[model samples]
Target: MGTTQLESVPEPKYWHLKTVLSEALDSEFSVGEILPNERELAARFGVARATLRQALEQLELEGRLQRRRGVGTTVAPPRMGVAVGTEQRVWPGVGEDAWQAVGCTLAAPPAAVAAALETPREQSVHIVRRSRVSHGQPVAAELLYVPQTSAPELSAIDASSEAARARVVLRELHRLELQGQDSAVELGSARADDARQLDRLPGAPVLVVTTRYFAEGRTAALSVATYRADTCRLTFGASGVEILHGQERQAS
Candidate 1:
């Protein structure tokens, strides 16, 4: 909102504001540092409160700021990134890991998941739901699908089975070479169920990462993970150079 010369870079005011706020958070602002109220910030910037709020939203999406009901906005600490790859099934929260499974079910799969599993639309697959929390907030929710072929040994699994089926499915999958996987990301809103599991409001932005596992030239499994864009920066590759635009950005 701050006035600038015409020759200045052509960028949205909110984008500029987000950059300024991000810089402040990275340097002057400590974790949990309470920022000036929105009204004060808007007045100082010479922009409408709504405009300033938009800027704040972007910063919050980058995990730079967090706002509470009664409390003002504050700096949020960095979020940790758990590597995503076609690797062994490491038990959630059991191997000193950040992933934790909260529930499991065998239900009719979504069309996308059903296609990936190469199974009949009517057939059900094990949906292993897990949550990944870093610092104090939930960062991600994962839905791992286990096709019947991949879990033939689960016939004995029951309601009180203690997540044994999920464990067994992952174990069988690990035996293969796990040669490669194909993945695509898209912007999506959190469904009601995912919202509850992720501790987010319905329709909140999420980074939907879909993966198809491969072993010995055949499909192994499929996993769809929805990460809270407001609290996570998904890192993928050698040095994590991808932009933090969430699911709303155009593919590069």
Candidate 2:
């Protein structure tokens, strides 16, 4: 009989480091506690700075750690559960919505948004910028596209300023009878503008949520909102008690 050779299995350094760091976070660290400097951590772990950084990035994505550009890394608190689905279908800005209008502009939306809104490519739409803040931290940035036909009541006077137009666009949208709404969520990287508003680096992890508003048997508006994947737990259903772990979902 021929001798059988055992195959060697090698684990990725960063992945292994991430596992070790995760345990440490659970037993050794507290929320908001500052961690050791990257240089010291890398040396202590006997790993390259790049490897350590990769592990740290993974931790941050899992909401286990929080990293700032100027400030050092710190333990992150539990992700906030943000309700995405509700029992009743209602237009945004109708109830006590969490979004706050930032600005508005008349411009041609992206090709995808135009297609979703069923609008002509050449026609400009009302682009309303909004931001969501939770626990005093900016969590999401959104761009709501409202076609001219959907919000025909808006006037030139309303477009004179960004703030005024934002309110007008939302107000006009409320006039229409909202028949239904739908949303889809996926993982994505933050765009430059969105990253700036979210106070994160460009290309950071984000949960892209695309929502469509229906009125008069047609798509009235389309909203693209990007939430910080590191710090938000997008919730659904009637009861808001359900919580999701970001790392487990990401791994799947």
Candidate 3:
């Protein structure tokens, strides 16, 4: 008879450490409470510093912890739920949108954005930069692209200043009758500019949202917003109830 061999299951050290630290956070830590320094924690857990840090990074990504450059890590508050889908189709900045425009400029968008907008590769478009703040912390950064043909009424006077150009482009966009809108969300890493706006390190985990605005039977504009995955829960549709993180799970 031939001997049979069983495969062994391998579990990563960092994953196990992440679970232990997560449970500790739930039972023993309070929001805004600082954790022990990395070296001390690693020693206490009998794990390498790099292993401990990997666990910490996972906790931060789940919004269970917050880490700053110079300051030590602390327990994070519950993730804020931002509404992504609403019943009415309205232009961005038209209603009670949370985004605040920072600046605008004329530049050629990325290839993906150009393809979405159906604009020529060499054509310059209006790029509006915006940021979102939640609970006094920056949570997201957005780049809104408007093709020149969509906002023909914008004059050279508005182009003199960044803020002026942003307003002008939005005003012209509102003139069009919004037919529909569609959006998709995916995981991504923050780029340099987006990282600066989100107050995170480069390559930090992010939730990238791509939205396309339709008008006059054509694509009018495209918006790409990157939300801090560590501190945000992108919610769709309406729900009266809110879910609190780090709280004990109810019996199922």
State which candidate has the highest lDDT: 2
* lDDT for residue 155 in candidate 2, whole number 0-100: 38
The sequence of per-residue lDDT tens digits that candidate 2 reaches over residues 1-252 is: 111111221577888788788888888888889999988887777778998899998998887887766778889888876668766787767667778898998889988888898888888998999988865788998999999998886635336668777988898899999999899999898899988899888878889989999999999999898999888878777532223443433211
User: Which residue pairs in model 1 clash with each other?
Assistant: none
Instruction: Please provide, for model 3 over 1-252, each residue's C-alpha lDDT reduced to its tens digit, 9 standing for 90 to 100.
Output: 111111121568788778778888888888889999998888777778998889898888887887766778988887766667666788888866778888888888888889999898888998998888865789888999998888986635336667767878888899999999998999898899998888888887889989999998989999998998877787776432122233433221
Runs of candidate 1 exceeding 4 Å displacement: 1-10, 23-28, 67-72, 85-98, 135-137, 159-165, 172-179, 185-189, 215-217, 236-252
TM-scores, in order shown?
0.70, 0.86, 0.86
What C-alpha RMSD separates each model from the true structure?
6.6, 6.7, 6.8
lDDT of 2 at 186: 94
Runs of candidate 3 exceeding 4 Å displacement: 1-10, 238-252
Off by over 4 Å in 2: 1-9, 159-161, 239-252
Model 1: lDDT equals: 0.67
